[model samples]
Target: MKDHVKKILDELLARFDCLRGCEKEIVTAYQLMEECYTHGGKVLICGNGGSQADADHIVGELMKGFLLKRPVSREYATQLGRDFEDGAYLAANLQGALPAISLGNHNALLTAFSNDVAPDMGFAQQVFGYGKKGDVLIGLTTSGNSGNVVNAAKIAKSLGVSVVSITGAGGGKIAALSDSAIQLPATETYLVQELTLPVYHALCAMIETHFFACS
Candidate 1:
């Protein structure tokens, strides 16, 4: 049992160590999130397969309190009095309401766009419709070579949205397309995806602590 626990801890520590190389990019992404919150801009995240799951997971963490406590807003305090439950506090405070959308959803629209236009245009189409200037678009690709994610970054750039990409260390097309590229040191797709999960969770926790703690 002791050996098993130590092995797991060592693996986790190693995974975190992989992030040291991309620490600057991670900080840049945090800054982008802070900017978006300050300016009332939204964040849009998209990816494929495991990357898609990562996108949704990051959004989920951002849409709710991670570690800090978010209080009820004055408006809600007045309406609900002082004894409202945690759910009411969240509803009143408008906690986790920072307008983030995962483009990986909406399969109907995605399939239609892929069928009519090009498959690679599915995510890009969504970005064209939903993205705006000053918004943040985060694209995740293990290999950094997904055409859809790359084109979405291109569209995001054309539309003046700040683009952040999380990809493997080889630096695929997404690295060139994005404004800030966070490259993981791992080469294998599964390892890259595994490393990406905590990187995004850390960013989400940082954003929450930085912007939404006081409500």
Candidate 2:
């Protein structure tokens, strides 16, 4: 476990009593991602509208440096320079990354899949295509009932992928489907989303600290 993992959650609890009683769920989510990355599995995220942007934002933080500077090892740096013409430049600039993909970002495929098949099945299709055993799918929906996100959760479950959710006051359909659901104590959609940012930010920081600290 990362040293800062517990610290981050503790900080959240100090700042937000509304998050009381949900510490375990939040911790479970961090553990799930930690396990997935440790086992060489990636995270797949999906949502709709604002949630879609959240999913993308998560990928942005994870697929590159967030808190710590994940410098390339000397061996890998040498290998990069040996392998390609611009390898040294690439090596100098690139940071170690956690494998993560925003399922909602493939605009072309999303459109084609929605048009060619079931519209609500877009997320499900992405889950089926990208998910593998041990991978984690994080479905974000304020209402917890987004059809596409729910469908994706269902598929992820069938395929032995771990499902974690971030939703509002009530853990909706997605909560039932998830292995762990961190439900914020907010009824309004925007408030729920407002709280979600900190929760995920904590998790992302913990995961990054876990992987890059010793390296």
Candidate 3:
């Protein structure tokens, strides 16, 4: 693990010591994500309500620069030059991205599923369509048991995908289904979300730093 990543975890512990017990799980999540991305696997995230927002936020950070300036590679720059008039401009501005998809953000598909088929399986349907072996599904639910997120995780697992569940105190049903579960010490939904933000941000930074900082 990178020092700064560990540093972020330590700082979070300092601010909320009750989360001290979750350190090991958090590290495991980081390691899994690193291996996934290193091997060209993408991440699929799902949640509800505020957690949905969190999912979108994570995708935003991962699909572009978060803590580092992830300039496009020279190879890509050259390829773009041969294809378009504004190739140099496009290449210069484009950033290397870690592929990610927020399963909660598609309104059309979600509404269609809810209206025509099983409402709780919207995320699961997306997972079935997009997930592959070696990819990861990050499910966020303060109660550790959001139905849709849980279903998506279950489907993901069935397809040989790994699951990382982020939740509050009990590490509920979703935790049991997850390969890595980060159960923070808080019962209130808002409080759990507050803690989740920093944790994922640290993860994004760690990954970004790993590839982009030295480049």
Candidate 4:
């Protein structure tokens, strides 16, 4: 990791002392995410209820500027201006992005699949559709055992997509299914969710610094 990226992670650990022992797994998750984005692969995230919101939150931070402005590269900006009349304007207005998708955000697909086929399999189906080799799937469940998220992880693995699970202590089944399992020290749902926020925020900051920081 770059010094700046590692700094963000260090700050996370300092702020949340409870995350002390999870250092290795947190770094491992960051590595997986960094590798996935570096290889031109997107991320697929899934969860349930509050965890679902967290998944969307992660996508929000990733797909646009989080801590940095992330302006387009000069080469792309120049090409944009040359290719179209408003290309320069468009380029100036757009932000650099890390591609990501929240599986639970597709209400249409989720509801239809849940009603027609299997409720727990909705996320799994989306994983099968969006996941490809080199992609990464992140599943968040307070208990580490949301059936749908677990199923999604399973499918992600079959498709050769790496899996990262963020959950409370013990990490349940999803943790076992993951390539990197970040089990927060807290076990209660709310406490676990609280810890989750900072961890992911730090992850986003680390990744953004790695790819978009001004050197």
Candidate 5:
């Protein structure tokens, strides 16, 4: 039992170490997210398959509180006084929700765009309609070459949204279109997807923390 526990701990530590190595990229993403929130812009995320799941997961974390204890505003604290054990709810609600939209969530629109316009233009068309200057468009692709994501990145660039891409090393067209990119060292698609999940989770947590601290 002791040996098993030790092995698990070691693996967890290694994963954390890997995360630390990607610290700069994560910080950059956090800063971008903060800027968008401060300027009243939304985060638009899109991807395919497992990367699509990653996009939605990131939005989920940012839309709600993570592990940190929620913070209460002075108004709530004054009203609740010593009975502020319920302050967590007030704090959670007080922290304004950052706007985020997962492009992968709209199946009907996506299918319509894909069928009528072009498969590659599905995400791009959405961007053309919804994206604005100063918004952040996050494109996720294990291969970094999904046609839809690449087109979306291009549309984002044209609309002046800062494009950020999370992809495997040697990311192709999507990387080329992005303003900045977080490239996982893994070459295998599955490994890249596995690695991307936690990185974006950390990014979301960091962004929320920064927003809470500043606002």
Candidate 6:
């Protein structure tokens, strides 16, 4: 890890002592995501209820600038200017993005799949369609046993995609199935969710710093 990115992880651990025991797993998850992006792979995320909102939140941070400007390279900007009359404007406005998709955000597909197929298979189906080798799947379930998220993890693994799971203490079945799992110390749904926000925020910040930090 780069020094700046490692600083972000260090700050997170210092602030959340409850996460002390989880440092190793958290770093592992970050490495999995870092490698995925390095190899030109996108991320697929899934969860349910509040966790579903968290999934969208993560996508929001990743697909756009979280802690850096993320401007496109000068070469790419120049190409844009040469391509069209409004290319200058486009190039000036466009920000580099980290590719990400939230499986629970598609209402139409979720409803259709849940109605015609099994409810627990919605995320799994999306994973099947969007996942491939070298990609990463992030499953956020407080109990670590949400059926849809767990099923999605299963499909992700079968497709050779790495899985990172964030759950409450015990790690649950998803933890066992994932490539890396960060189980927060708290067990109550709300408590776990509370800690989850900081953890992912730290992960996102570290990743953004790694890729876009200004020299």
* lDDT by residue for model 1 (137-201), tens: 99999889999999999999999999999989977988887777989898799999988887787
The sequence of per-residue lDDT tens digits that candidate 2 reaches over residues 27-80 is: 999999999999999999998888888999899889899988998888999999
lDDT of 6 at 140: 95
> Model 6, 1-215: lDDT tens per residue?
66766788889988988788988888888899899999999999999889989999999999988878988889988998898899889987887788999898899999999999999999999999989899999999999999999999999999999999999999898998999999999999999999999999998988888888862
Q: What TM-score does structure 5 among the candidates reach?
A: 0.79
User: What is candidate 4's lDDT per residue for 157-185, written digit by digit as tens?
Assistant: 99999999999999999987999999999
List candidate 6 segments past 4 Å from native.
Answer: none
Candidate 2 segments exceeding 4 Å error:
none
Query: Could you tell me every candidate's TM-score relative to the true structure?
Result: 0.85, 0.96, 0.95, 0.96, 0.79, 0.97
Which window of 10 residues has the lowest lDDT sum in candidate 5? Answer: 1-10
What CA RMSD would you report for each candidate? 6.5, 1.3, 1.4, 1.2, 7.2, 1.2
Candidate order by TM-score, decreasing, is 6, 4, 2, 3, 1, 5
Clashing pairs in 4: none
lDDT scores in order: 0.81, 0.91, 0.90, 0.92, 0.77, 0.91
Lowest summed lDDT window (length 10), candidate 1: 1-10
What does candidate 4 score in Cα RMSD to the true structure? Answer: 1.2
**What local lDDT does model 4 show for residue 144?**
90
By lDDT: ranked, best first? 4, 2, 6, 3, 1, 5
Task: Show the lowest summed lDDT stretch of 10 residues, model 6.
Answer: 1-10
User: Which candidate, 1 or 5, has the higher TM-score?
Assistant: 1
